[model samples]
Target: MRRALNIKNKLSFIDGNISKPTDSFDPLFTPWEYCNDMIIDWIQHSIGFEHRLTIAHADIATNVWTDLRERFSIQNAPRIFQLTKAISSLVQNADSVSVYYNTLKSYWDELEIYEPMPLCTCGSVKTLTDYNHRTKVMQFLMRLLRLYSGSGSSI
Candidate 1:
């Protein structure tokens, strides 16, 4: 998932941002994935946690893309699209979401759905004065997850 998140670090200088220069270093850069079985096990031990929600809930992965696009409206639309596609690829498509795959492939090309939403937080109006965009999107995703999961289960 990190592969497509484009985390876009913003150079924060909070004391803990950078690791202390300790003599007991394990090489400055060895390209770690942070994927440890123990981490997953620990997180699973929580009371309410399930698989990271997949982009394709049921047979309609496009629903997620459309919902995210409409939610962001301007900023983050493209990012959200990419993130959803990544989730779809990682979960539904098993890492491949090309059009050649047909049907579900359309979800992969969601990045081009509307020429990519602006990443810059410019002078764009908020999606709502009653129900903000982010909240709506979260709700939409939750609904889709619930509809497919059929048990209000996480993921």
Candidate 2:
């Protein structure tokens, strides 16, 4: 949504970079209102039917955007737990190397979305990312069949 708004050059409507003009006499008031209504329509069209009412009374694009973000950006504990359990219990079993790897990668990708690494400017983020990569590699190796374990064979 952010990317689409940016592409349309309307991100300012919801990003707080531009504010609605207060004076009716101001020349920018008309154009700003028009753009705001357009953005509101785009947001409403993009969201689900069940969520439309939550922002139906919103008069500003920023308010609508904020309400939607607050409503949907919460961390879901049950989903995170499910993903973790699945990753831990997964094994190569009878699947080919590529199939097993792809399945594991998919799980990992979803888990990352739920539990994303923190960002900072202290340079610790790089170290943490490296550690995470090494950990994932180990987990993948640990789940492989006995024949492939420590065999040094190309995947």
Candidate 3:
């Protein structure tokens, strides 16, 4: 959704790109209205009516998205605690190596989605990417079962 909007150059409208118009119809009027309509339609179809009501007054896609994010993606203490507990208790007993890794990756991915790493104003994310990779590597090693104890000591 975001990629498509960006490709259409409509993303700026939602991200606070404003312009002053002297006449009734501004140059950005049509496209901006189009983008907002599309976003509202998407929200209505993807989310139920109850959720749609919360964003009904939002005139721009950004406002609607921000409201949705605040309602759904405000990661708090309890969610963090649950994710940490799940990560700490993960095991690789019955599953194959690939399965175990995939499961762990899913949890890590969810954690990331909820608590995204901070990015600079210039959009640089290298540090966050590297940190996530290192954390995943360490998690994989730490969760190995007792059968790999001898091999683990070599590391």
Candidate 4:
């Protein structure tokens, strides 16, 4: 949603960069109101029917965006656990190398979404990312080794 709003040049509406004019006498009030209403409508249409009522009474785009974010951005532990289990149990088996790698990559991508790396300015983020990639590569190779051993082949 942020990307979509950014693409449309309306991210400022929800990001609070463009404050609404309070006075009706202000010349900016009319244009601000129009843009706010449009942004509110865009948000309303993007959400589910069950969630529409929660933001229906919100007049400000920023308020609506905040409400939705607060409601849905909680960490999902169960999903993270499921993805972790799947990644640990996955094996190359009879699948082609590309197929096995793609499946593992998808699992890793979703798991990262749930447990994203922390932002840092100490220049450790790159080191952490490199370490994570190395770990994933080791896991993939270990699983492939099992497949080769079971097939009477030496790696």
Candidate 5:
């Protein structure tokens, strides 16, 4: 099925052309207006992906989860997988959320840590109260994490 567009954080560039901003760090809870931080832009520009590699998807995944968790409780497996897959693809063309995060890790690892860097922002769907697609995906991520880590599970 065709995915919904990330309307809120869609790149601000108009007419398909705009110069990069000087700052690369992104503001918390805000759409990425512009980045003065060269490396973040470079990753998005030169690498052709917001993620560095499969491992680097953490930044984006974590943020997405955190956003959802603020409102509702997360759910468990299978159903969660479905949700995650949808959200993951919606964010980028990743095979899975894990792959996406790892990809980002790969890119981030290559960068120097001297400066604060922001991950790819997909914008807020919190306002889209009419739909629960985002919430479903977030619940799936929480289950995947719990299953893998065994921390949220009871014996």
Candidate 6:
């Protein structure tokens, strides 16, 4: 949702980073208003009925988006704990190696969505990403059963 808004260059409206023109005579005012309307419409159509009713009285897209984020985003400790618990409890069980890995990957993907990697302003994002990648690979290898691990020399 945020990616869609950002692609349309309407994220500023929802983030409160865009300033409204003081006068109706301002040339950018109309375009700004139009963008805001487009964002609000997109948000309304995207959300569920219960969510819509909660933010129905909101005069701007920013408020609606903010409220939705506050409600849905997993920034709380309980959500984090739950995800970590799932990761800790995961096992091969009856599933094949490929299926088990995929199941684990799904949890990691969701966790990534909740805890996104930061875009480094210091031009170290590539280095950071590579490090994160290696860490995840090592973690996955470590979780695999010894019977399937084959030989360490092969690595």
In terms of lDDT, the best-performing candidate is: 2
Instruction: Report, for every candidate in turn, its global Cα lDDT versus the true structure.
Output: 0.36, 0.90, 0.73, 0.88, 0.37, 0.78
TM-score quality measure for candidate 6: 0.59
Predicted candidate 4 versus true structure: per-residue lDDT over 55-80, tens digit per residue: 88889999999888886667889888
Clashing pairs in 2: none
What digit string (tens of lDDT, one per residue) describes model 6 on residues 1-155? 88998897778898999867779999998987788777878898898877777766666778778788888775767776787788777776677779877987887888887888997799788898899787766656666767767743365
Instruction: Write one digit per residue (lDDT tens) for candidate 2, span 1-155.
Output: 99999999999899899999999999999999999999999999999998888888789999999888877668879988998899889999999999999999999998887789998999999999999998888878888999898663453
Model 3, 1-155: lDDT tens per residue? 56866786666655666432346587767765666787667666778777777776666667776677678777677877888788889989888878988988888888887888886776568867787787788788788877875665576
With a 3 Å backbone cut-off (N, CA, C), the pairs that clash in candidate 3 are none
Candidate 1 global lDDT? 0.36
lDDT of model 1 at position 8: 29
Candidate maximizing TM-score: 2
TM-score on alpha carbons, each prediction = 0.17, 0.70, 0.61, 0.69, 0.16, 0.59
Against the true structure, candidate 5 reaches a TM-score of 0.16
Candidate order (lDDT): 2, 4, 6, 3, 5, 1
Which residue segments of model 2 deviate by more than 4 Å? 85-110, 137-155
Q: Write the per-residue lDDT of candidate 5 for residues 1-155, one digit (tens) a residue.
A: 00111242332222123333346553432332332132233333443253345324333332332333442233344545554455454432434657755554443333213222334355444445324434544544453533354542442
What value does the lDDT take at residue 121 in candidate 1?
A: 54
Deviating ranges (above 4 Å) for candidate 1: 1-72, 77-100, 114-155
- The CA lDDT at 87 in model 4 is 89
TM for candidate 1 is 0.17
Number of clashing pairs per prediction, in order = 0, 0, 0, 0, 25, 0
> Model 3 off-target regions past 4 Å?
18-28, 43-50, 72-75, 113-135, 145-155
TM-score between candidate 3 and the true structure: 0.61
In model 4, the number of clashes is 0
lDDT (C-alpha) at residue 46 in model 1 = 30
Q: Which ten residues in a row have the lowest lDDT in candidate 5?
A: 1-10
